[model samples]
Every structure is written in structure tokens, then in C-alpha cells.
Target chain A: MKAPAIDKKVLYAYLEEIKDPEIPVLSIIDLGIVRDVVMNEEGELDVTITATYTGCPAMDMIAAAIRVEMHTLGFKKVNIRYAISPAWTTEWMSKEGKRKLKEYGIAAPDKRFSIPADGVECPRCNSVNTRLISEFGSTACKALYQCNDCMEPFDYFKCH
Target chain B: MSESLINYTLHLADNALILGQRNSEWCGHGPVLEQDIAITNISLDLIGQARSLYQYAAEKMNAAAGKEHPAVTEDTLAYYRTEREFKNCLLTEQPRGDWAQTVLRQFFFSTYQYYLYQQLQQYADTNLAAIAEKSLKEVSYHLRWSSEWVIRLGDGTDESNRRMKEAVNELWRYTGELFVPAPYEKELGIDPGSMQADWMKKVSAVFEEATLQVPEKIFMQTGGKTGVHSEHLGYILTELQYVQRTYPGCEW
Candidate 1:
């Protein structure tokens, strides 16, 4: 049986439902991985995502999850393409998304392009006194850091 | 000179090749899903670096042998060689003891690589310099990640501190090899001496933050550059080569 037609708006909503497994509060759309959602005349849904890193293992899972979620929502023909160039940067994060990250205890990345030569600032207390603890944090996309003021260790989304 | 250049390149490639294989083992076994993905990311980066270095070395070998593309590509050199023929430094061959150990390993290796690549960026050879310039950025992040973990684990609770110390002690012996200049480095005009002091300064600064003592022992285990390797090399090669060995000349 042919799958029922789906609209771009509905497809986007369905994608919004798929949250980042790491930070559950943030959806792929919020993370900027869900680039553009388009529905072709054939009723097929095409989703483009930019991976945080080239070999990010989550790309496969994320793609599969998107497909499964869309199929469950009645869109069977789903195409997920990974856009490598123009690469994903922290700049893609939405303001609301940054706030969600702060609430989650992880610091939102510095929006400024001219990142200091020393290191990034701590998201928790807005302290540049912070120090990078590890490059490989809880995830590939984050680096471990400690806010000296808050005295709490947190993950900083490493700018690609 | 070319011989030593090949040797030095193999040394760099082996560290990355072996460590990448080890890190890949954590594909599904990471403490957390995010951590698992992170380790894989690091693994891919190291593997990519290894491939680039190996390809360059292979090209040099082909030129010396008066052939195009040589009889073997980088993969052949990486997988088909015996343990004794493998030239990665001793530190990379060490087992991934735990999360602490793995982080410590990354810390030490990345720190050295960051400085090494930075200096390499000035090499007279344009291709080598270009590769170094590109890799420096990636290595910088790796170093930062490793350094952050060192501080966290070192200053953490008694259990973590103890584990971090133990990990450092276990890996310290291998640290010596990083500074020993391979003959090819000198012959190729890649004097690593300038970066040695700088690397030491940065490494000590990180160690201080971690509250760990830098082991003062001067003796270092060597031989990777000369194709003499540790016992672990055999097992590492077997695992790394299994697929390629089973299907020679296979391409995806």
C-alpha cells in the first residue's frame, strides 16, 4: 500500500518531536542539525542535516530515528542527506536553544566568531576563568570544563 | 634521508593507527552514549591523520622505487606489516585501562601532537606543511579535551585522583619516545628541537593543574621508528588487519 501524503509543516513538526538523545530538552531542529525540510510532489519527505563532526556516530542513529519517526507519522519515503560543506557551527544554535542548554547545566557555546586564543568561557557563570578539562567530554561535540565560581563541572559545546 | 623520513612518518602513523583501532573498540562500550560518540570522533580524526601521513610516506617510497603509486597503498603498510615492522611509539600501544587512562592517554598524545604539528606547519615541504597546518586545529581540540579531563580527574574525589595517578604512572614510560628525535627528522631539516622545550613547558603546566607529578626518569623505551615494537603490536596488527587480510585488494 502507498504511504499517505505528508506536508512539510507536518514533517517538520514530526522532526521536532525527535529530541537529541544527549540533551533531551533539545530537538535536532534546535541543534541546527535539521537543516531544511522539503516535501516533494511524490509525497516523499527530504531532510538535510549537518553533522557536528565528520565521523559523528550519531549521524546514522539520528538519520534512522528521523526516518522511523516520519514513517510512523505516515511518511514512508524519507530521504536524509548529510551536508558536509559549510560545516555545522555553534552559530547555528538558536537563542531559545541556548537557553535550554543553560538550564540543562551545559553552557551554550559562545556566539562570537572571534573565539579567544586561550579558550572558551564557562556557560554556567559567564566566567572566562574557566578551564578546559578535556576535549572529549560527555560527547564528541562537547568539551569538559569547570566553572570556578559555581564550582561545578559542566560540558561546553566545542565550536567546530 | 628518505629512509629516515619514511621511518619517522611510520612512527607517527603507527601511534595514530594503533590508537585509532583501540578507540574504535569502544564503539558500543562507552560509559555513555555521548561519550561513545566522542571517542569514535577522536578515533576517526586520528585514523584520518594516519591515512594522510601513510599516503605521503607511500608516495615517497614509490618515488624511491621508481614507480607510480607503489605496489602497496597506505592500508597495506598499516595492516600487512608484522609487529616488529610496526613503528608506533610505545605509549599508544598501552591498553586503555579505563576512562581515566584513556583520557590521560589522549591528553599526553594530543599535547605532544599539538606542538609537533604547529612546528611542522613551517616545514619547507609545502605538502607536509599544509597537512600539519590542517591537522593542528584538530589536535588542538584533542589536547584541550584531554587536558580538561586531567584536571577533573586529578582534582576530583579520592577515588578519581588515585585512578588518575595510577594511569599517569602506567603511561609515563612511553612519554619519553615522543621527544626523541627520529633520524629522519634531522635529515629532512625538520629540527624538532625548537618545539621540545615548548612542549615540555605546556605539558608541565597541564600536569601542575592536574596535581600530578611529572615522572623525572630520563630513560625512555624506543624502537618504533626503527620498526622494533612492543609485544602488543602483534595483537593490535591482527585485529586491525583481519578484514583486509581476509579480503586482499578489496575496495568498497
Candidate 2:
């Protein structure tokens, strides 16, 4: 029997529903982990992803999730590939992803080239006067921070 | 799948794993929160690289031997290997004594890694080149971070200055072994010795800015490349391998 022809649009719709295991507020699509999805001549659906950090433990979960989503969508010939070149950067994060992060209480990364030593606005009060509690947060991709004004501690999505 | 290639990959994996394990000791014990997290991030990057290298090594070994040989995995390579089987440099296997020592050691190693990976990005082997390309960016940040700490601690205050000097003196001996490449390493990868001149220039510039002196002349340590490490590695492996050894194929 011939493999059912799966439309690229349907595959993308399914992918957009798979949320990041670490940050449930955003899907892999919003986080820019999904670099591209294409149906090749052989009809294999190839999904390319870039990791937020080299050691971001969520990578395994992300890959597994992608596989599960594709299988659910009736895609049998799905291959997940990693793109390490142009290494994943905070710049790839979508505008909607940044908004969701704030709503979820993790401070979005500031738009700066270097690791920002200061001016990490607190997710709680939107206070720009925040202090770095720790350079590392509960996860490798986040930094610990506290608001000087609100005194609320939160995670900052660290820029790579 | 060549033995030399497998060995070369193992060599890289071991260095990253050992050093990453060492740096992880500072997870929550750092003097301050920011630096603590920074060091751990460095640890994560190293271990991540080690995982990819080990996976590559295992896959290559499995392909070469077929079903006649037992399975080889990243865990087995890391947790089951004996002291003599590990091929990391002595600098990486050394103890993470103080914050200054940790920072200084990272500075030396990261500088070498930056140049090493830069060359690796252009290797004839595409897989190796890809790994290098990804890792080089992370190592670049590590080099800068450690370099700043060296300068800050060296020039900062009286006590910090004294400690930084002590760290510099103690770690300097191990620097020599990093440049000496094993025969297999040369065959499978670029000769590490070729990167020494560039490594020195970067190191010297950082040391100069740190207002610290590199010893005018010194004796270099060897043997880590040959799997002969200091007593420190034994203890390191004990902690590192404890879980996998105890559980036998334990998973997170």
C-alpha cells in the first residue's frame, strides 16, 4: 500500500501544537527550534531543529515529541535532523514567544549582543531595576534573577 | 570506524567529560550566584560535547565490529572505563581547588579549545567539522569569560591577587601536556602542537592584561595523553562512575 500523502500544512499544524517541555508556554515553532519542514522526493518528512544550548537537556524530549506528533498525524516516513551551524541564538526567538515568556513569569532575554550584566527587567513588576540572583537558573538556559522593587525572584531566558 | 578515529573521538570525549565533571563540583558552592551559574553553564557545554563525541565513537565502534562484539554506548565508555583507558590532559584532571584555580584552569583550557575547534571546523571529516563548529562558539564564550575572571581576580584586591598568583603558578606545569598529541590523534585529527603558538599568544595577552606573569621558563608535565594521570583522576572517576557502576545501565 502507498503511504498516505501528508500535506506540509498539516505537518506544520501538528508541530505548532507540540509545546517545549521546558517552557510549556511556547511551542517549538514559537521558540524557533523548528528550523524547517519539507517533504522530500522520497516522501520523507524531514524536520530540522536547533538546540537552545548545546547541553539543553530538553533536546531529547523535544525530538521525541516531534516524532510522536508526526506519528499521530499519520506520517510514517518522518526523519528529525539537527542543525548545529549558525548555532541557536536568542535572536531566533519569535516575538510571540517573548510575550508568552513574560506572561509565564520568566524574563525574556534583552536585545543585546553581549551577556547583559544589568538591566534584566523583572517579569513580575516589569521593573528594570533588577539584580542577578544567579548566573544560572534551575535550567542551563535560564539565569536566576530577583526584582529590586517587587522582591520577586524569577528565571531569565539567558542569551547564548 | 578506524581504530585511530575511534581513539581520537574517545580522547576528545574523555577530556570534556573529566573537565565537565570537575567543574560541576562548583554547582552550588560558588562564591556568588552569578559565577556559580556561569561555571555550571561551562560544565554543561563540555558534557554536551562529550555526549556527542561518545555517541559518535560508540556508533563507529559498533559499525566496525558488528554483532560479534557487545554493544558500546556513551555510558559504557564514560562510566565503565578504567583509569588507563581515559585519555584526557592532566590539566583537565587536576583538582578544582579554589575559585581562582578553577577560573585559571578554564582560561588555559578554553584558549586551547578555541583554537583546536577552529581548526577542527575545517577537518576533512564532515561530522567532526560539524561538532567543532557548534562547540567552537560555546568555547569562545568560555574563553572570554575565564579570561575576564583571570584579569579581575589578578588585579582586583590583595587577597584575590595572592590567590590568583598561586593558581597561576600551580596550574602552569600542566599546560605543556596540552600541546603534545598522541600518534593516533595526529593521524585522526590535527596535530595539537600546531595550535600551541596561537594558544600562547592568546594566553600571554590575557596574562599581560591580568597583570600576572607567565613563568619565564618551566618544566612541562606529560602522560595524561597516554592515560597516565595524577592521583586526582582516580577520585574524580570514583564520583563520576559511582551511579552507573552501582546501578549498571542506570538512566536519568
Candidate 3:
């Protein structure tokens, strides 16, 4: 017996509904962790993902979430694979992702790979008057920043 | 599974694992809140690298099983291994003295790793190469962060300068083992000896900027690469492996 095939577009829609465990405001699709999703010849869904950094603890949670979602959607045998070659960079974060992060109180990473000399624009008051409190923030993928105007501390999605 | 390959892989894993553990000690005790988080983040990166390398080594160990070989997992490789079986460099196993000592040790090791990983990326082993490539980015960040700190501390206050200089002198001896090419490292195309000149050059440049003097003594320490480690490693393993040893097969 053969199982019906899943439309790739529909698959992404389901995956897009799954937000990042850390930054719940942004979905995996927006975070650029989901590299590829395709149906194998055996009717199994193969989902490829990349970790944000070398030892991100969120990777396991993301994998588990994907498996659960697939199973709930009747994907009896979904294969989740990790791709590490072309390492995930902040450049992969979508425009929508950046907006959502800002809306949720985190500054987005710039396109540049190096740390900015001044500081990322503060997410709280949208103030340019900010200083980097630390190169690393509450998480590995973020840096701590403080806005001089509003005097609010926030995390900035770091440029990997 | 090639025994030499497994050993070589463990060498890399042990260094990352032990160093990560040392850094993790500063989790909430960093000099400042932000730097505390920063060091811990770097610790996470190193620990993650260790896990990947250990997983690969465990796969190799299990694949070459005979009647005498036991089942291997990341946990087993990390916790079950005796102190005599660890192959990390001595520098990584040293006690994290003060902030200066910690940063200087990290600077030394990160500089070595930055060059080492660059070469390892081109090694014949694809998995090892991938791991190297992945780790290089994080290690580069570590190198940059620690380098800036070295210069800041060295050129900062008089007390800081004295402490930084003392740290440099004390930690310089442990650096020799990094460049000594072990038998397996050589076979795997890891020419550690060749990296020494570049490592020294990079260190010297940083030292020059920091306005600190590099120790004139060329005498070096060795032995960690071959599983013989300092007294510090035993204490580290005691705490690191405590949960695993106390409750075998423990999991969250």
C-alpha cells in the first residue's frame, strides 16, 4: 500500500507554525533553521535543519518538535536530518524574523559578520544611543545591549 | 574502525570537554554579569563541540567491537574514561586561577585552535573536517574576545598589568604540548609542529599590543596528548563524572 504524497508548500506551512523554542516570537522558518523538506521515494518526509551555533541546546528541542508535528499530521515515518556544512549564519534570518524579534524586544543581527562598533539599535525605544553590555547575551546567539535613552536591557540577535 | 582514529578523535574531544568544564565554573561568578554570560556561552560552544566529537568517537568504538570491546556512547566516553585515558592538552586541564589566568589560558588555547582547526578542515576525514569547520567560527569569537581582554588587562591598571604578566609567565609552559605532534595526529595530517611559528607570531603580536612581554624562556611542558595529565584533571573528572558515575545511565 502507498501513502498519499504531501505538498511541499503545505509542509512548510505546518513547519512555519512551529516557533523557535528560545525566541518564541519567531518560527523556525523565520529563523532559517529549516534547510529543506522533501518527500522520499518511500513516502517518508525528510526534513533537514541547521543549528544556530555549534552547541545550541535548542537543536534537540527543535528536532523533537518537528517529529511531533509530523506525527500529528500523519507523517508516520518522518526523517529529521542535521546539515552542518554551510554553517547557519545570521544572514539566513528572514526580514519578517527580524521585525518579529524587534517587536518582541530583541534587536536583530546586522548583515555584517563582525560586531558593530557602536551597538545595535535598541529594541525597546528604537534608540540608536545604545552600548553593548556584553558580547554574549542570555543566549549564545544573542548579545546583551542597553539603551541609554530608555535605560532598558535587551538581547540582540548576534551576527554569527 | 581504526584504533588510531578513535584515539585521535578522543584527543580533540577531551581538550574541548575539559576546557569547557573549567569555563563553566564561572557560570554565575564572572567578574561582571555580562562577561559571566559571555564566558558561559563560550563554554556551551566548546561543550557542544566536545559532544559531537565524542559521539563520532563512540560510533567508531562501537563499530570495531569484539568480545572484549564494550558498548560506547557519548556519556560513556566522557564519564567512564579514567584520568589516565584522557588525551587533552595540559593547558586545558590547568586550574582556572583568576580572571587573568583564565583569559590568558583561553587566549593561548584559542590561538592554537584557530590555526589547528584551519588545518583540520582540510584533513582527509570528512566528519573531523566538518567538526573543525563548525568549531572554527565559535573559536574565532573566543579568540577575539580573549585577545581584546588580554590587551585591556595588560594595558589597563598597574595591578591588572602585574596580574596579566604573571599569568602569561605561569601559563606559557603548558603551551608546548599544543605544538608537539603526536603519532596519530601526524598520521591524520595534523602537522601541529608547523603551527608553532604561526602561534608564536600571533601571540607576539597580541603581546606587543597589550604592552606585555612574552616569557623569554623556551622550556615547555608535555604529556597531556598521550593521556598523562596534570593533577588538576583528576579533580575535574571527579566533579564532571560524578552524576554519571553515581547513577549509571542517568538522564534528564
Candidate 4:
């Protein structure tokens, strides 16, 4: 016999507790990497997720954190799956997540398809007059930018 | 199992691996902080692409019944393989000579990858297509970054222009290998030759804008795709595989 049906909402709540290793304020749910959660007939808890970047080192860490969180939630058979088809886009990042990211002093990605060209508002001084220092920042997903208004450099979440 | 497909996958993985390795040499050695981070970030992306391709190749190799290591993995493929067994193109294995050379090399490879991924994303092979599609996004940035640098350096001060010219002369011969389809690539129905025109058009336009001359007398070098490599690959493998060979399967 299969285990009792668990609420998908409850599973989401558990998942929301797991934060991104690099970006602490955003959880996997906020990042939109958690694609689906399924309770199979065999009572396995399968979480389908996508990587922000195929080679993002955080994927393995995030997957491990998911396993630990699920275990704490009492999931005995946890299967973490990866999907790469439609590809993960910054568009999937949540509105609340964006706000949090901005508050954390990093410019959050503005939603839209194509590659991220500049026009990132300074998360500090809230100025549109920012120049890019480098297209690569501290992490793979971020790029370094400096605000002419604030004269302070910060990271911009690239539109990939 | 389709051996040719597996080899093609390995070739793709190896190209990314070797190029990533070369780029990573600039991790702490860059002229400026931003440039250092930029090259390192590109290295991360390429290495990440390599990991996905290697995993796909490992799975294909293991699917057969008579495999020596039934549990072969990406790690084994990357760290255990000898130099002659690597199937990366010669251009990727070339030494990262100087800042100008690195920029030019990245420009050439990223330009090739941008077009290559565009083609591969439309190909019949789904997994390869998916990886290509995903990589296309990152490769676009790489192309932009490298292209901008190529122009900046080539069109910059007199010293910068001279260095860029030297880089172009030193590196031009190795690029031909990218268009030369290997035996495995031919078997897998991927034509490297088909993308040559597009690649050159983009390169020539960039060179024009950079005020640099495209090589007129191109004596194209070949090999590396078929496993024959420059001496550089041996040194690279020695550095990369040192820990793994010394203590097999050692993990952090």
C-alpha cells in the first residue's frame, strides 16, 4: 500500500524553506527552479527541478539541500529530477523574490526574454544611470555594475 | 550503443573541458579585477557545459553490455583519460599566450560556438539539442564579451594593435581544425563545414571593425579532433589529472 497523500501546498512550504546557496534571500521556489512536486503510487516524493545554468555549482548543493529538507519533512523515498528542455529563464523569478533581491542591495533581473542588455537600476540609489564594470560578477548569474549616482558598485542579476 | 554518437559527445565535452582549462589559467593572473572575473566566469560556464556533455557521454558508453567500467562517470572521463584519448580541437588546446591572444582565442571559439549551438539546437538529436539550446544563451554573452574585447584591443593604442596583430598571426592557423569534421562527427551527421561561411563572415566583420587584417594565406592545421594533439594537451592533462591519477577516485 502507498503512503497517505501529502498536500502539495505543504510540500511547497517545505521547499520554500530551502534558500539558494549563493543568493540567500531567494529560495528554490523563489528562483523558480522547483518545477513540480509529485507523490507517486510507490509513495516516493519526486521533485523535478531545473538548473539556472547547466554548470551552476549550486545545483548539486541545492539538490542536496532539497533532499535534506524532504527528509526532515519525513520523505523516505526522495527522487530529485532535472529538466533542461524549455530552459530556465530569469522571467520565472517571483515578484516577491525580485523585491527581496533588490532590498539585499543587488539589482534584480528585469523580466523579458532576450539576453540582458543594461538599464539596470541601482538597487541602492535607485538610479537608471549605471554603467557596467564587467559582465561577470561574483557568481555566474550576476554581472558587476557601478552606479554613477551612488558611485557604488553592485551586482546585476543577468537576464539569462 | 551508437559508438559514433558517443565519440561525438565526448568530442564536444573535451572541447569545452580543454578550453575551460585554458581560460581558468587567468583566474588570478588577469591584468585587472574585472577582466580576471570575466575570464574565470567564462571558464566556469564552459566547464559546466563540459560536465553535462561528459555525463551524457558516460551514460551512452555505459549503456552497452560489455563495458569495462559499467559505472563510468563524468569524473572518470575527465580526470582519468590520457592526452591522446582527448578529442578536443587543436584551437582549444593552444596555450593561452597573453591577454591579446586569450581575447582573440575566445573571440574565435565563442563565435564558432554561437553558430554551432544555433545549428545543434535544431538538430535531430534531442539531448545534444537541449544542451546546445541551453549553452546558446551563455555563448551569446561570451561572443559579445570576446568580440568587444577583440575590437577594443585591436583598435586601441599602437601597442595594443601590435599585440592583437601578433595574436592574430600566432593563432590563425589553429582555427581551421574547428571546421574540419572528424570521422565521428561525420558518422553522427553533424557537418562542421556547413557553418564555416557564417563563422568567417562574422569574424571578418569583427576584424574589420577592430582594424585588424584577416589572414590571407591560411595554411590550416588539422588533428586533435581525431585525438592527435599538440604537446600542450599532454601538459594540460598532466596538470588536470595529477590528483586523480595519483589517487584514483579521490573525491572532495
Give candidate 2 misplaced runs (Cα > 4 Å).
A36-48, A67-86, A102-111, A114-138, A143-159
Task: Give the TM-score of candidate 2 (chain A).
Answer: 0.90
DockQ for every prediction shown: 0.11, 0.49, 0.77, 0.84
Task: Return the TM-score for each candidate structure.
Answer: 0.65, 0.88, 0.95, 0.97
Candidate number with greatest lDDT: 4
Which stretches in model 3 have alpha-carbon errors above 4 Å?
B66-70
lDDT of 3 by residue, A11-129 (tens): 89999988889999999999999999998667789999988887899999999999999899888888998887777888888999999999999988876526644557888888888
lDDT of 3 by residue, B1-252 (tens): 288899999999999999999999998899998789889998999999999899899988888885487778988999999999999999999999999999999999999999999998988888899989988988988998999999999999999999999998889999988989888877766679998999999999999999998887788989999988889999999999999999998899
Per-candidate iRMSD: 5.0, 2.6, 1.1, 0.8
Q: What DockQ score does model 4 reach against the true complex? A: 0.84
Candidate that beats the other on TM-score, 3 or 4, i.e. the better one: 4
Clashing pairs in 2: A135-B34
lDDT score at residue A143, model 1, on the 0-100 scale: 68
Cα lDDT computed for each candidate against the true fold: 0.76, 0.87, 0.89, 0.91
In candidate 1, the second chain superimposes onto the true chain B with a TM-score of 0.92
Q: Which window of 10 residues has the lowest lDDT sum in candidate 4 chain B?
A: B61-70
Among all windows of 10 consecutive residues in model 4 chain A, the one with the lowest summed lDDT is: A110-119
- In candidate 3, the residue pairs with backbone N, CA or C atoms under 3 Å apart (3 or more residues apart, or in different chains) clash, namely none
